[model samples]
Target: MIPSLRLLYWRPSAAALVRTRALLPMAEFYNHETGDGAFRLIQKSDYARALQGARVGLCLSDHEGPMRASVEYQLLDLPVVTTEAQGGRIEMMDPAHCRVVPADPRAVADAVQELAAEEIPAGAVRASVLSRLAAHRAALPGLIRPHLQAAFDDASAGVTLDDIGKVDLWRTRDAEVIRREVDAMPV
Candidate 1:
């Protein structure tokens, strides 16, 4: 745990650990090392609660469809620093609330610092995201209506995994044995 929480660098999915790891140095620099500049990878839903005391958010993805995590930050009115995304995610970001920076520790750290200092209103950022989502939400019925019956009536196929393939691959290391090392964790 960071002694003082200033930034919340969220890994949108468990597989996205690398992106956050590369930038841990930035978290360390800003959080001043008592136990902070944190990263989250739990398969849990209380993500918003983790942002209770954070000042800025970091969402730097190389490719994403809509990048909901970045928008979540906006919904909470937390300023964000992000890299250019490949899947039209930037279209939903608020230009005044977010800074499109490179995926560098120094640049991101500076952006975090700059964003934290600015007095941006919560409503403005939230409105920016909502307004953009309006179009997608409005079109949702039309898109789903045609498939609604099939979606509800079709018999869904069960998941099939190759016996040799890894299970829980999202949170495992290569060739690592699966063990519950509860004793290794901090109290």
Candidate 2:
């Protein structure tokens, strides 16, 4: 049997929908448009509360980019068990912060079990999330300017959300990103 990951997938395409429906018994299907997946899908109004209520935030995004959900999870201090494809942003998180693992079921299961058993300090986790969010927000304007200019100069080079694919939450030394961020801040 698979471990409880409390999957929170958004509206997927028809092809993806068919595949998931066939594989699993549709524990909960959500469509904010028609309010189709309310309890099963969950109410859009309560989406935030729902995310906060969960024990863990599971993101298997293969084409992820600066995942906001991941940050929210960190803010909530819920342990994460995501794929490496999500990338290095999570490197700052300690082993205790969350369990960044492979996307596979077995690996996810292991991470989930470990996090569930561990004692996580929600306050500290939330602080980390807030700090990271601020740093990322500050850097975003500069980092994205070039990409935007490139897109404007050449329509073919537009940086669409789809272009940012799955990332690896663990890349370089986690502390380095934070330290560099601190250094970059103007006194």
Candidate 3:
């Protein structure tokens, strides 16, 4: 029996648009198509649930992201076949974890076929997710510290106006006059 090789994506475009018919008999194309068809859009909440008992998660895009669904699949320990154009800061499905292939339907088909024939090692899939999580976990502080400091400084110190040269005098004076007049006016 062929294992479940499902495409979990937010939108269908590019090769996905074409592969719907190309991979129709084999791949279960999911995501927003109705009327007596195997392909159907699953709600975001139900993504992980829908992936239950699935073997492969396929995403074939010229420009793909390090997607949440892909990560979820990784967390669920499912093999993935995706293009290089994924969005995440880190490659969640590294070469060790999943099949990274050319952004073409045939290549995607081959990867899916390979995954279906051979079971994806649970350790590898989990480790890929864990590795990405660990890297992000380790880097979280560094990633946030600089931005937080910049924000803190901006909030606390603000943009100083010593000479007031940068300020548009008309707008500034208008605001100042309004404030002074409001303050000086009878309560």
The model with the greatest lDDT is 3
TM-scores for the candidates: 0.54, 0.60, 0.59
- For candidate 2, lDDT tens digit of each residue in 1-187? 3443245566677788678767766344434333654424544456666665567767666656667677667766777777776454565454556776766878887777777777776587777767766776565545645534544555424344334333321232377864785468653
lDDT string for model 3 (33-119, tens) is 332444466766677777887777765555644457677777778787876674662366676547878877678878877886685
TM-score preference between candidates 2 and 3, better one:
2
The parts of candidate 3 lying over 4 Å away from their true place are 1-8, 11-41, 153-187
Q: What TM-score does model 1 achieve against the real structure?
A: 0.54
Clashing pairs in 3: 32-41, 64-85, 64-86, 65-86, 65-87, 66-86, 66-87, 66-88
Ranking by lDDT: 3, 2, 1
Per-residue lDDT tens digits for candidate 1, residues 104-127, read 767877877887788987678878
What are the per-model C-alpha RMSD values against the true structure? 13.1, 11.8, 13.7
